[model samples]
Target: MTKQPAHIVVAGGGYVGLYTAHRLQRRLRRELGRGTVRITVISPEPYMTYQPFLPEAAAGSISPRHVVVPLRRVLAKCRFVPGAVTAVDTEGHTVSVRTVAGEEAGGEPLRIAYDELVLAPGSISRTLPVPGLAEHGIGFKTVEEAIGLRNHVLEQLDIASSTRDSAVRSAALTFVFVGGGYAGVEALAELEDMGRYACRYYHNIRPEEQKWMLVEATDRILPEVGEEMGRYAQRELRGRNIDIRLGTRLESCEDRTAVLSDGSRHPARTLVWTAGVKPHPVLAACGVPLDDRGRVRCTTTLRVEGVDHVWSAGDAAAVPDLTAPPADPPALCAPNAQHAVRQARRLADNIAAAVRGRPAADYRHRNAGSVASLGLHKGVARIYGRRLKGFPAWLLHRAYHLSRVPTFNRKARVLAEWTLAGLFRREIVSLGSLEHPRAEFELAAGSRRHPEDT
Candidate 1:
């Protein structure tokens, strides 16, 4: 009698899940051929987004499709499940997955048993209870949000350009971004640059007329790049006429009006929230040990603490940072793409080692500095104990991220975009109507109905 192959289920298809599955397929190729190992990846999306390029994608620097890598195309050897894992029962060795809507299964949730489980569901936007946030605020986390923001920003220009009311025009032209982390800073910088360029097409709206404000609760921005770079970034932004409000919090955003803790109020149609992220809520229900911040508790080896046949990493895992200096108190790795990508590789190798009855190795890698692109020909980078700013840093930022954005196919396409963009102007067309394609059609249909028919 032949024995059934052991099934390994991996959750999430972001940086961690995709790379882990890719490495596992390469390591267990022979075993896979003999039908002894089966790897299944379950994720909410069919593709993995290279999040570092999101700002550029939002600014129309890179094609949105190029920033996302399709999982099925990349992981032919692994079983790809286009759904989300809602719950995990480690003791029962089963995971409850909710299939995407419009599927043959009627969007029902099903349970699948696995011998080994990898938890890397990743994080979601950490929002506050600020008034009107749920209705007015937009996030910068997903590719959809990035593309939508681009369209929405351009649409605001159209509204401001054609509107007669000064109040409406002011609100439309005023853009407010909360949080000063890499996401908020990069997004604001890129979009502001795009908006400036886009103003050439609008006769009524001037570049200076657009109010670009950045609100940060902290005293500085871009903390990942250290104090010196953060200060440099602030100066550069202010030089570009951006209003930087430090040590300020957004108290409310009711009726498209932003109220800051500093007792200032601004009527803005666009409000982008890139404040931060929290671990996926699914982690809390997975029956796994979680840390104080609601992240999966894992050792340096990337194995879930006190949990057999289970491993975790990425933003959702509290894995100790082995690279931290001896003087610093014990700390976990920062939840960033730099750490997530490396941890995925180590987690994959460790899982393979355990399967082959070998000892697992600890995951350790020192911080490799930080890079931030402030629009075209502008950036700041801190690498190898050296600081770089302006054009040189901008070139390095592009080079570094271009090399890291997954598959060679995507890299080629992105390079082609940059090459073409150099020879031509940036594309700033608005496609906001795509979000509600049927609205106009519905209105037309309704208008055609006679009163007598009603």
Candidate 2:
């Protein structure tokens, strides 16, 4: 009797899901062609976003279209399912998926059976119960959000330029970003730089008039780059007139006012939330063992702890750090792209080994270090015990991320854009109408009575 083909279902299309499937296609080319192995990737968005370029995308340094890789094009051999995995039945070896059409039509979820499961649903923004936050705050995790933020910031400038009311103008010019991590600092810095440069076009708005604030609960920023380097970053931002409020938390944002833990309040129209992220909710309902932090518990070999025929990695899994020293408190690998990309390769290798009845190898690597960009020509780096700052650091930051952006097409496009950007003035055009494309047409067609009538 001929053995049935093994079906592998990979959840999420971010770093882990995309890379794992891509590597698997190359590793199992013969098996895939012979109908002995099949791979399926499920994700909400068809493209996998390179999040490191989000700040540049928001700053208009690179076109947003080039910041994401199309999954169907990259993983030609793997079946692509444009849907979200709502739940996973590990014991039954099936996953319930809610496709985009099913969601719009309010239909039942589709169930898919798999011989092996790769849980890489990634993460969602870790939000708190802060009042008015849900209604007022913006997240910076997706390409849509990044581009939306860029348009919003420019729109605020337009508002500030035309508003007669002092209070309204003040609020419109004020921008507050919470969290001091890479997403927060880089985003705020890049936008701040762009905002400052764009002020030249506005006759009434001055760069100094725009209030850009960074609020963090911790006492330091850029903790990934070490304390000394973090301090250098803090000093660099502070020198740029950025209000760096360390050891402060956002208590509330009701009535367009940001109340902080330090008993300070700022009236701002923009409040960006990038505090942190937690594993996807599907992990909780996946019937798999999870660590205290809700990440899937996994062995060093990337196999799900105590669960056969299941594996996990990336932000969704708590992978042990074999390179860390033996101590009372164990160290888990940090959930960054550096580790996620590396872990995905290792995870793919282990899966291939399991298929061939070979022994799986443990995932291990010493962190190379951290590099962060604080806007153009300004950055901080701590690599191999050597510290760099300013222009050199900025150049290194670009070179490092450029080498890892995935796909030769993207790398070439990004490099060409950068070359053009250096020779030409930055584009400050605001395309806010993209958010509501039908608004003007609705008014002309008498579909709506007023502009505000959505």
Candidate 3:
């Protein structure tokens, strides 16, 4: 009797999923060729987004298309499924997935069996129950959101330039960003810089007319860069006339009016939410051993605790930080791209070893520090206990991320873009209509149709 091939199914095509599958294809080349093992990657998006570049992409520093890796082209040896995994039945080794279109149409889900399961569904933006947040708040987690924000900001500038009413102009000129983490800080700074540069082209609008606000619930921003650097960032932003409201929260956003916890209210047309993220909710239904925080509990070797033939890592897993100080209680790694990329590589190697009946090694790495871009020629960095800021830090931020971005083709294109941008002025044109390309066509069609045509 012929033996069946072992099937490995990976969930989520983000950093973890893509890197894991790519490593597997490289390590298990012989097994894959012999039809002894197969790998399948499931994700809603066909491309893996390089999230670190999102802020730059939003500010037009990098093209949106260059920041995402096409999964089919990169993972040629693996089966790629463009869908979402709804549930995982560990006992039956089956996973239920809904195709993108099917999920939109409310159709039935499809199930596939697997011999090995990799849980890397990643996390989603963590939101609060603040009033009017659902209707007025915009997130900065995806490329689509970044693009929308760019267009929205430019559209607001256009409105401010053309409007005569004081109230309307004030609202159009006000831009508010909540949360002071990397996403909030970088996004606000880059967009504000773009807006300032764009003002040179406007006849009526001045850069000072734009009110840029940064709200943070914590006492300081950019906690990852240490206190000194964080304070430096604060000074830099304040010099730009950005209102940095520390120890403040967004109480409400009713009717496009932002009410702060400090009893201050402002009429703003834009509100960006980048507070933080929680583990993917799908893990709750995956029948895996999860920690109290809804993160999959994993062994030091990246295997799902108390489960065989299962592995997990990235932001969705509570993997112990072996490199942490001994006195630290519950030393789990932080949910950052730095850890996720490294964890995925280790997880892939360990999985391959388990399949080959070899001993798996535990993952251990010291924190490598952080680098953040404030805007063009502005940044902060803390690497290996050394501190840096300003243009030097900004150059380091770009060079480091440029080296880390996957694929030589993408890196080359990004470099070429930077070269061209240096020779030309920044493009500040707003293409808001791209969001609803068919609006005009539909409106014209409706007007041309007779009422009795139906």
Candidate 4:
């Protein structure tokens, strides 16, 4: 008699989910061939977004296509389910998911049963209680936003350079970025560099004419690269005539006018929200034990506390960092890609151990330092108690991520793209029409006289 295969369901295809599934596939290769375990990954997206490269993709440094790995190709052994898990029935070991394509029909949620489950749903953007943020600020997490910001910024240059209306031009030329972490810092720096380079092609626009402002509630920027590197980054940014305002808050924004707590107001059309992210609300619906911060409370071994056959990792899991001194390693892994990758691997190992009736190992990872790309040939990096800045830091930043980006095919393609980009100029064509393809049709229909006027 043949033994039944165990169904292992993994939620979310982000860094954590993808890496976990990757490791699971490799570790369970023999088990899979023997029909001992079946791994199924569920996510709304079929591609695993390499989020760290979003800024570069926005700045046209790296091709956007190369930043995302097709999950189907990467995890051929796993069953890829395309949808978001809406609910979890821990007692029954089943998850309720809604297919993203089902919204049009008001379809019912589909349920899938699993023998073992891994929760890695990741997180959503954490917006502050500020006025006009929802209306004015664009998020920088997804590839769509990155490329959209690039298009919008470049379009702003076109508007400012061609228009004689000072008010319109002023609003168009001003760019404001909120938050000072790696996302905000790298995004502001990269887009500014792209815009500055783009201005060379505009006959009427000077790079200096465009105003750029970075507002951080904290006192510094690029906290991931440590304090000294943060200081150096600020200095370099300021040297480029970019405005870096710390200890400031966004008060409100009325229409295109942004007002700051420091009593500064500017008519800016661009506002990027890169403040931070909180755990996905799905965790709450899962009815699992949560930490004070709402993350799934987990043991050092990555198993959900008080829940049998359930595990969690990544930003969504508040698993204790054993390396931190009774505290949180001076930080709870900083919620970066580095930690997520390592945690996923450890999480997978522990899951495999649990299934085999072996001891589940603890998840302990020492920080290997951090890096941030600040436009072309500019960045900040820290490695093994050593810090680097300027061009060398940027090179290190690229090299490190290139190695981490999944798959040899993608790595080679990215390197080829980088080599070509260094020799040529960035491709700045805007595909904003994709977001609203029927706008023209609607406008034309509204303008027509219902076929009465020939």
* RMSD of each candidate relative to the true structure: 1.8, 2.7, 1.6, 2.0
Tell me which of candidates 3 and 4 scores higher on lDDT.
3
Best by lDDT: 2
The CA lDDT at 453 in model 1 is: 89
Estimate, for each residue in 171-228, the C-alpha lDDT of model 2 and write its tens digit: 9999999999999999999999999999999999999999999999999999999999
**Scored by Cα lDDT, where does model 2 land?**
0.94
198-315: candidate 1 lDDT, tens digit per residue: 9998887889999999999999999988899999999999998999999999999999999999999999999999999999999988999998889999999999999899999999
Off by over 4 Å in 2: 447-454
What tens-digit string does per-residue lDDT give for candidate 4 at 303-404? Answer: 899998899888898877677777533335556788889999998898787767789888898779999988889999999889999999999999999999
Q: Clash number for every model?
A: 0, 0, 0, 1
Q: What is the C-alpha local distance difference test score of each model? A: 0.93, 0.94, 0.93, 0.89
259 Cα displacement, candidate 4 (Å): 0.8
Instruction: Kindly give the stretch of ten consecutive residues in candidate 2 with the minimal lDDT sum.
Output: 445-454
Off by over 4 Å in 1: 101-108, 326-329, 444-454
